[model samples]
Target: MPMKASGAADLTVVDRFDDGVGWIAYPDETMQRASHAVESDGQLWVIDPVDAEGVDDLFEEFAEVGGVVVLLDRHKRDAAAVANRHDVPVYVPEWMSGVEDDLDAPVKQMTDGVGDFAVDRLIDNPFWQEAVLFDGETLIVPEALGTVSYFCASGERVGIHPMLRALPPKKLRQYDTERLLVGHGEGLSEDVRQEVRGALSGARRKMIPLYLKNLRGALGI
Candidate 1:
C-alpha cells in the first residue's frame, strides 16, 4: 500500500522503494508532478522540490534534509526554497550555470556526476537535458520519461511524456531497473523494464506530430 502524508493535502507517497527511498506527488490541475528523497547514512537528500507550502512539515516526517539536487535546468522549481529552509546545498548540472543566478542558497555544480549516487547523464538528446538517478534497484528519472496516470488497484501505467518523446533514445538499456520514479504522473513499481523498453522503442512514431508542432512554434510559422 502507498504511504500518506500527515497534514499535507496535496502530498502523497506515490512510490516507495525497498530501501526506504520514495517520491512524493504534488498534483495540480494540468499535471501531477513529483519530488524524490533518498535516505542514506541517516540523512535525506531531496531532488526537484514541489509545492513549498508544506515542505518543512514533510521533511519533519522524514529525516533531516542534507542536500538538494536539481536534475533539469528548467526544473529548479522549489529547490532553492527547500535548501534555504534546511540550510543545505543545491546541486545542479554544470551546463546550467545560469540557474545559480535564480537560486538563493549555496549552489554546487554536479560536474563529475553525483558521487556514489549512481546517477548517469542521458547524452544525445536534442530537445532538453536530464540525468537518471539510480537508488539501489530503483531508477529515478527527471524527465524525457514518466507516467501519465495514477496508481490504482489494477496497476500503474508508464510512458514517455509527450514533450520529451521528440528526442532520440538514450542509453537506458544498460540499467537493470526494478522500480521507476518519475517527475510526473504516477511512479511505476511493476513491470518496469518492459515499460521502459516500450517507451524507448515505440515512442518515435508518436513523436513525429509533436516534434513538427514544436518546430513550428520555434520558427513562429
Candidate 2:
C-alpha cells in the first residue's frame, strides 16, 4: 500500500520517556506506523524512522545521531533517507538476513546491540527474521507485538501479531520492562511487563476469536 507524506505538523508524539520518544507520522492510517528516537550515551538512535519534514528538530536533545536501526526485516521505513540526512550508518542486527542489500546508505552490522539495549532475535525463518531491543526498563519490539486494534481483541493491552498468534513469542515475558515500544502502533508504559505477559499468555487462546473479529472489520460487518 502507498503511504502519504507527513510534514512537521502532521507528526503526533506517542511515547515519551526520559531517554526516548515515539511518534506517528501517519496517524490517520490503521497501521499507525511508529518511529522512535532513543538516546543512549549522548547518541540518538533512530529506529524504523519514517521521514517527516522538520522531524530532525525532535533529535536536538541528543548531541549526535549514533545510527538508524532497522529491527524488523521489512521495516526499512525511511531508514536510508534519515541516515543520509544525519550522516550516520544504518545499523542492522548481524543476525538479521536479507536486509542489507536493500539499503542505500552506509551499513553497520550490530553483533550484540546498540547503546544500552541488548538485541534479541525473536523470529527467524526464511520469510521473516525480526529482532527486539531492550534494556531492563525499555523494550523496543519491531513486530510480533503491538497495541493497534488489528493486533488486539477486546480487553487486550498488547497483542501478538495475528500471524504469530498460534505461537507467540513467550520469551518476551522475561523482560521486566517499564515501557513497551513498538513499530506499528502506540506503546505501553503503565504496568507494561504485566501487559506483555498477558498478551503472550492469552495469544493462543484468543487467536480464533481475534481472527473472526478482524474478518468482520475487513468485511465491514
Candidate 3:
C-alpha cells in the first residue's frame, strides 16, 4: 500500500506488478502517472498526477476527504483537469504558469524565489528555498540535471542535477540526499553528488574535443 505523510494519506509507488510494469493503484491513479504521495497540514497531497484515469480515481477519492492538488513547477501534466473537476485548487511554482488551468476555478501560483511559492522550510543555502513542493513531500523539479531531493524526516535529501559548473561551498553544504525519486531520464539513482560528478566529467570531456579538434583529416588528425 502507498503511504501518507500528513493528517491525510500519503501515496507511494507500491506493488509494481504485471500491469505492464505498473505500480499499485492509488484511489484513481490513471492520471499523473502518479508517483508519490504524502500528508501535510492535515491535507492529503498527490504528486506528479498523470493524465491517466487511475490517477483521477485517486484524486476523486481524496477530494471527498479534502485532498489538495499541487503541481510542482511545470509538471502539471494531468493536474489541471482534475483540479477543475473536483474544485480542488492546484499549487504551482511562480516561475511557471498556465501549467495548470482548470477554468480559473482556483490556482495557487508558487515559486521558490517570489510570492507565496517561497519554500515552507529553512535550509543551509539560499538556493535551497528555491525548493518548493508540488504536494508537500513532492519537490519542485527545476530542470534536467536539476538538483532536487527529498525532505526526509531523518533529514536526508538526494537527486541528480546536471552539473554545468561546480557548486559553491554554500550550495555544496546543502547537498544531503538519500534517493532520486523521479526524473524523465532513464537509469538514474538518488546518489546525487556522485551522479552529478560523473555527468559533469562527461560533459566537460565532450567540450574539450570541440575546442581542440583537428580539421585536416576530419576524423582524428
Give one digit per residue, the lDDT tens place, for model 1 in 78-177: 7888898789899887765457888888998776544346656774244466777785577778776767532111122666666556564557766688
Q: Which stretches of candidate 2 lie over 4 Å from their true place?
A: 1-9
Off by over 4 Å in 1: 1-9, 18-26, 112-115, 123-127, 149-156, 208-221
lDDT assessment of candidate 3: 0.36
* Poorest stretch of ten by lDDT in candidate 3: 147-156
Q: Comparing candidate 2 with candidate 3, which one achieves the higher lDDT?
A: 2
Residues 103-217, candidate 3: write the lDDT tens digits.
Answer: 2447665444222122432222323322333322223333323322211111123222322223411332233433333423222235655654444444444433323432322
Stretches of candidate 3 above 4 Å error? 1-35, 56-74, 95-104, 111-142, 146-173, 183-193, 200-203, 206-221
Model-by-model lDDT, in order?
0.66, 0.88, 0.36
| Full ranking by lDDT | 2, 1, 3
Please, what is the TM-score per model?
0.76, 0.95, 0.45
**Deviation from native of the Cα of residue 167 in model 3, angstroms:** 11
